[model samples]
Target: MSEVPEAEVVFVVADLAGYTALTEAHGSKQAASVVTRYVELAQEALEPGTRLVERAGDELLIVADDAARALRVAARLRDAVEREPLFPTVRVGIHAGRALEQDGRYFGTPLNVAARVAAHARGGQILCTEEVRRLAGEPDDVEYRPVGPVRFKNVTDPIVIVEVVAGRRAGEPTAVDPVCRMLVRPETAPARLPFAGRTYHFCSFECARAFAERPEAYAEA
Candidate 1:
């Protein structure tokens, strides 16, 4: 092991949302391709002050010298993944605090918070802790909305989470999954069904099945 030095940095954790479902539905080869493309796109989106710290299967940990810069990078990553046809949606969680860095890896409470926050987010959403929201201040065209406080396992204090909204780019057609509320691109949706003269797009077959079982329940909702 190497020496651990404390550093103040912005941590961002991102992963493909619905990754497990994608693997089970599409098999290992397609899942592996998704991971590979994710890494490529993420690396290309990196700015000067930010660096990719680690990649574990479908998840990525990135560190940035500044909170605002990290938020920009995160948003860019989200957009990149969204525009890619047939790729699963990406979810991101960000936080800023002191963490021990050793041999190009990071460890500490802040990192854990970021990971937990990421897990809380649905696909296509960007979430950040209050610390990050405060540090990043108010960037132009970006808004942070509070999602409420959440307690994480092994974390002593409850973290106030916020959704980082940059707004969706115009002209991209997307629909909401009635069951999970995940945003699905109509062109890439794996499952779609027609009901009541309107078509519903789903991110997965399971959601489609649920909708089929009770069309009125979701159609009205």
Candidate 2:
């Protein structure tokens, strides 16, 4: 077989949060149906030059030659899922770098980093590497917040993360406590839990402790 080429591309990974708990709370069949719906929505959101590489369980891996296009598609996918209440919240991550592409599959650092970034994102959030931010340039009507440097497993050095805020409504800043499902102000919340790429506020220390114990249990709640 001919050797596949290596090229610079934007890698994106969007994972469904609370997938395991959703399966347990509902059933495998219902969870499977949600996954199917997510896949369909993803297909609708991808751009012309973008390619869907694979679906790893509740995650979707995609690739695009244009960094800006990839960011746009990722934002679109997030928005699409957000509009559907039946679908679970999804978190997205994007990275731009050179990678090996063989037989329609990608390998190397870019893909690995993208996966790591996605792992850091909170449900309903979009996180991306600084490289992607630079490549994509400044977007209109979209806010980008630096989330500081994050250390990922097996990756040397720290990667800076940027949160993409495109469709969020401004004013009245209130965050939902993952443990108790209560809304609280970040400034007034009695306790806070920082995990992955986001900070979660809680009404009480007890609720924060509960979330710390098993975060995935409250990911969808």
What C-alpha lDDT, on a 0 to 100 scale, does residue 209 get in candidate 1?
Answer: 89
* Whole-model alpha-carbon lDDT for candidate 2: 0.81
Question: Each prediction's Cα RMSD?
Answer: 4.0, 7.1
Steric clash pairs (candidate 1) = none
Q: TM-scores of the models, in the given order?
A: 0.83, 0.76
After superposition of all CA atoms, the RMSD between model 2 and the true structure is 7.1
lDDT of 1 by residue, 1-221 (tens): 65667989899999987677677656789789889999999998899999998999999999999999999999989988877766677899998899998768888889988999999998888999998989999998799888999999999888999999984555444776666554578887899999988999987887788789988977843
For candidate 2, lDDT tens digit of each residue in 1-221?
77777889899999987677567645789788889999999999988889888998999999988877888788888878766644566889999898997767888988999999998998778999999989888877567899999999999989999998776433333566665443356787889877877889875687778788988767642
Error in Å for residue 85 of model 2: 2.4
Q: What C-alpha lDDT, on a 0 to 100 scale, does residue 150 get in candidate 1?
A: 96
